[model samples]
Target: MFKAVLSDSNILKTSFDAISSIVDEVQMKADSDGLRLDALDRSHITFVHLEFKSALFDVYQCDEPLKINVDTEELMKVLKRAKSEDIVELTVDEGNFILTFENEARRTFKIRLIDIEYEAPSPPELEYPTEFEIPFSLLKDSIQDISIVSDKIALIVDADKLIASAEGEFGDAKIEYLHGEKITENAKSVFSLEKIKEMLKADKFSETAVLKLGNDMPLNLSLKMVSEEGELTFLLAPRIESEE
Candidate 1:
């Protein structure tokens, strides 16, 4: 048996919302340390890693480790009913995941677990030459602006600045940030604008996001959660242009 309580329900809700867009079902591993999840999208172009440490919860109790397979969309439906200030409690009993919210009134939901056949794959070890930190608001605004003209965006990072640019038949747009920490190496890559937008959904859960990039390689975006207890990370493969 396992039980955990959180004072703010939005933390859990926002997490699910960020992931459910790419994956429908996920396996949540609960242990003494905390809860962890790693899932790849159906196309395998994107991978998501999540962690919520025991200290992040108001109350955490687990005698043994447990892995629960849940449908993210269904879980979001239950979490959607929770008020922002409600205390959220989660428990596992007899193969069922129980969620309870307490505020002025009490609400309870029991969702059945599924037997997941897939196992979490080991993430590839990659080295990014360029790394920088940017506020979520700035990144979100840049993506939105570039997306207006093109379906893909080119990210260029050098010693002094980070740039996002897009061009299409309609027009072209570019946004640059020259305020972040300086980097030694330079890297440039193209990525799907839609995928970046989808991953930005986690911006609501974090203020600042760290980014890593390489030439013609995937983009790694990470958001550290409240109090630095947990993190949500996305690895998006770059969109390669064909030589015709």
Candidate 2:
């Protein structure tokens, strides 16, 4: 048996909104430690990792560790009805997950759990030579600006600066930020602008995002809540450009 309560519903809603676009279904693991989710996109090009510590919840109870597979879209639909100040409670029983939202009025929903054939794959460990931390708004705005002209963006990080640029048939746009201690070494990679935009949905939960990059390697973007209760991490495969 497992039951958890969170004081604010927005945290759960925002988290679901951030990942629903990337994954259709996910397995949520609940234990004494906390709740965790790890899922990869259909194309296997994007991976998302999320963790909610037990301390983050108002109430947390778990006699044993359990894994529950849930349809993310359906869960998001239920969470969408929750008010900002509502207290959200979750419980699992007989293969069904119950979600309750309490404010002036109480609303409860029971969603059936589905059987997921595949287990969550562990993310590969990699060393990134270049790392930097920047405001989430900066990355979001830069992607939006470049998307107007191109479908992909080139991210280049060196000893001095970190730059995002896009080149299209019509024109090119670039945004550069000078590095302090946030960046090191030199690395370059190209990624799908649309995918990155989707991942940025988590920006609402955090003020700054830490980015790690390597030449022709996957990009890792991480965000931690201001309250330091939860975190969202994403790994996106690079788009290899063909030589002319």
Best by lDDT: 2
Superposed by TM-score, candidate 2 places the C-alpha of residue 178 at a distance from the truth, in angstroms, of 2.1
Model 1 is weakest, by summed lDDT over 10 consecutive residues, at 118-127
Q: Residues 82-130, candidate 1: write the lDDT tens digits.
A: 8898999999888789999998888999988988898865566898888
- Candidate 1: which pairs clash? none
Candidate 2, residue 77: lDDT: 92
**Residue pairs clashing, model 2:** none
TM-score, cand. 2 vs. native:
0.96
lDDT of model number 2: 0.90
**Per-prediction TM-score, please?**
0.96, 0.96
> Candidate 2, which segments miss by more than 4 Å at Cα?
none
Candidate 2, residues 44-122, lDDT tens digits: the string is 9999999999999999999999998999999989989988888999999897989999988889999899999998877
- Worst lDDT run of 10 residues, candidate 2, spans 177-186
- Residue 225 in model 2: shift from native, Å? 1.7
